[model samples]
Target: MVAEVFPLADIGLPLGARVPDFTLPDARGRLVRLAERLRTGPVVLIFCRSEGCSCCAVRLRAYLRALPELAEFGAALITISPRPPVPTLSTEDEHRRSLDVLGDVEQRVFADFGLRRELSGEPVPATFVLDRQGVVRARHVGVDHGTTMEPADALAAVEAITLG
Candidate 1:
């Protein structure tokens, strides 16, 4: 499917809000559509910092560890990074993650999701758990280099959406 990006004026994308669909390029250079993934199950959208951030790596590993369980519920985990480094870019190729480490080069998608970095321009962390209908179920937006949620906790949020 083609990319669908909802205008900021159209939807605020707050909690319990119906998320507008988006299309982004995965690490493998393939387009991933939010609407398409929602047809199968819920989605875990992680807005991460660049490769220079330490916690980004930790969070990636944690989520990767939790992927199997997330997939059991037919949920998908995706990371959106504005300007991910070379090594960080290889992560998907290295481990063959089931999810995409999408590149948001323009950060337009980032802003479309109602996200902004710190005053210093260092990317912050944010997580949104969306159900099959594309309505946001859970979310955590950080202020600085802070992380949003632990992988397991993120799974719990997704579970609440899927199982509840």
Candidate 2:
């Protein structure tokens, strides 16, 4: 069982707290900066276990299916993992097959976000929705096998932020 901790480090990113800006490479070694992406629209950042996590895989597939639609609102969905870089070909293919499949293996960014929660020998699953200004608008930390934020709910949150 996952122990409940008071003042969970990964819960409730405050409405006005600025998300620390970061530059992490995508699957193809392309650099992506939080500041740069925010210039266009809201960024939905998903920090998950690199690979081998079944829950992460399921979350990625769900994001992959929802990507095109999410793009309509100019919201960029990004998924990062601590998995080491795969071969160039495999990396590209994986990006095409799953969620953005772009992330850092060094865990620098992951550590910065405080998403690393060691539970039962596995890292906890976490999600953060950051507005264009870099403030975290929504946050979810899950310890369950099926923990994830639904695409529709995320989209609605973005829409509300944009319209407001």
Candidate 3:
């Protein structure tokens, strides 16, 4: 657990609130539920626009590089998108395949989380940290790709929840 709490920017989901539970298919077409994953540890939900977005690629790659720190906290890295996981859409070279990119087919999951881009219907790049008990600890929501939270910020959130 993160003993020294770092200051947060702003989040849409209230702190300590329980988020909605839903199952979405992973890259392998396997159904994965948020609640089920919480059983193992905290989950860092990365709400990405698409593999095409350059900003998202940079942030995601950073997470990929920080896999060691994430594993220490027993946290899972999941990138969510409204579009289906296309085998051809290599968002950021080969390293992207290391991340679990799930598809929110109907976008109901995204809507449930209230993930929306400013002045656009697209989902904004956001990161949310949910503790093992299903309570949201911290989150960073962005209006656009350039403003999304850094991968290190997400890691900090995960550490906070896991250690707390």
The digit string of per-residue lDDT tens for model 1 on 116-159 reads 53234444467888899988888777654454577787788878
TM-score, cand. 1 vs. native: 0.80
For each candidate, the alpha-carbon lDDT, in order, equals 0.73, 0.68, 0.72
Q: Which residue ranges in model 1 land beyond 4 Å of their true spot? A: 1-12, 84-97, 117-122
Name the weakest run of 10 consecutive residues (lDDT summed) in model 3: 2-11
Candidate achieving the largest lDDT: 1
| Candidate 2: tens digits of C-alpha lDDT, residues 19-73 | 7888877656767787877887887888777666788877767776777666676
Instruction: Write out the backbone clash pairs for model 2.
Output: none
What's the true lDDT of residue 82 in model 1?
90
Pick the winner on TM-score between candidates 2 and 3.
Answer: 3
lDDT of 3 by residue, 18-130 (tens): 89998888766877788777888888888878777888878777877876677678787778877887654354533523346788867776777777533455665678888
Backbone clashes for every candidate come to 0, 0, 2
- TM-scores for every candidate against the unseen true structure: 0.80, 0.78, 0.80
Instruction: Report the Cα lDDT for candidate 2.
Output: 0.68
The lDDT of model 3 is 0.72
Model 2 lDDT at residue 160 = 72
Could you tell me the lDDT of residue 3 within candidate 1? Answer: 43
Error of 1 at 139 (Å): 0.7
